[model samples]
Target: MADDMTDNMLILSMISQVFALILRSSFLSGGLGDA
Candidate 1:
């Protein structure tokens, strides 16, 4: 049970990282385009 919980947490962390990167990239592109 503990192992399963740890796995779930790890997956969630990875997903959050990917989402943050995507958001950051889009913001950068939009800002550059405006300039």
Candidate 2:
């Protein structure tokens, strides 16, 4: 149970980081990475 929660949190954290990077890059470059 506790382990499940930890794993979920870790996954969420990584996803959030990736999402944030995409958002930031898109905003700065004015492109949604659809080169």
Q: What digit string (tens of lDDT, one per residue) describes model 2 on residues 1-35?
A: 99999999999999999999988888888787653
Instruction: Note the Cα lDDT for every prediction shown.
Output: 0.87, 0.90
TM value for model 2: 0.81
Q: Candidate 1's C-alpha lDDT? A: 0.87
| lDDT of candidate 1 over 1-35, digit per residue (tens) | 99999999999999999989887887888854653
Clashes (backbone N, CA, C under 3 Å), per candidate, total 0, 0
Model 2 CA deviation exceeding 4 Å by range: 31-35
Q: What lDDT score is found at residue 5 in candidate 2?
A: 100
Please provide the root mean square deviation of candidate 1 (C-alpha atoms, Å). 3.9
Error of 2 at 30 (Å): 1.7
All candidates: TM-score: 0.82, 0.81
